[model samples]
Target: MIQMKCRVLLFVKKNMPCVKMMKLSPSPDLNPLDYAIWSILMEKACQKPHPNVESLKRALKKAWKGITLVDLVKIVDNFPKRFQACIDANGGHFE
Candidate 1:
């Protein structure tokens, strides 16, 4: 009986979710250009077009390492145009 009780307690403890570590301070300083680029990516993400989300996630992840500020701005600025063209070609807005 004691062994079964101990096993149950151990199982419960093991199944409990771990607590997340909270940040104690603001993130290290980001360059203005970096901030701008990240802001653009975030704004686009919040629109949450499901079909594009995966592609956008991949692009943004890649952008994090390889892209410069200018590239990011260009991508962000062109997003609306690309989206609009798709809509036009499809004959209507995305439902």
Candidate 2:
């Protein structure tokens, strides 16, 4: 696993020299997708069971369309407060 990670890092460094990489931790407070988007998508898309993969895909697409620009803006605009909360917890989990 470590070797694969090193290989991926090397590949990224070689292919994307301008990109800066940092170690990432799993913290929903720092990731808008985890904190908000996924739940919204799941709630909207998974309200009923789908008979097959295509049905699920269609449902997800519909749910995605239901998300408005204003909703997205609000989610992004709330990032500073999330960041501050994460910081207040000293990089630990926050509620």
Candidate 3:
């Protein structure tokens, strides 16, 4: 009876989710929006004549409600060359 109880306890512990206990350490000294804005600015900076950072920021703020992940992906897809260049230069895979 004791062996059976131990086995059941072990199985329950093994199947339990530890998501709440997972550490969600934010990057030191940087806010979450900083990363997103920086990425957008970097991509904009690579274009000819460069883009207005304030205008991009304004657009982002205004479009925040309507934009979704699929919209962002479509924007990237529309700029295949630039997107590919960004991925290659940054050593990151987007797809």
- Pick by lDDT: which candidate is best? 2
TM-score of candidate 3 against the unseen true structure: 0.23
lDDT of 2 by residue, 5-91 (tens): 455557666766664665543776777678887888899999999999999999998887787665665775676688788889899
Better of 1 and 2 by TM-score: 2
All candidates: CA RMSD (Å): 21.3, 9.1, 16.3
Candidate 1 lDDT over residue span 1-95, tens digit each: 34543554454356533523233213212222333556755655545544666877776665454444445445445544654655576744332
Ranking by lDDT: 2, 1, 3
Any runs in candidate 2 off by more than 4 Å, and if so which? 1-26
lDDT tens string, model 3, 3-68? 543554454356544322233225311222333434564454433442687865665554453444
**Model 1, poorest ten-residue lDDT window?**
24-33
Error of 2 at 68 (Å): 0.5
- The best candidate by TM-score is 2
TM-score of each: 0.27, 0.67, 0.23
Could you tell me the TM-score of candidate 1? 0.27
**Model 2 whole-model lDDT (C-alpha atoms):** 0.74
Better of 1 and 2 by lDDT: 2
What lDDT score goes with residue 48 in model 1? Answer: 54
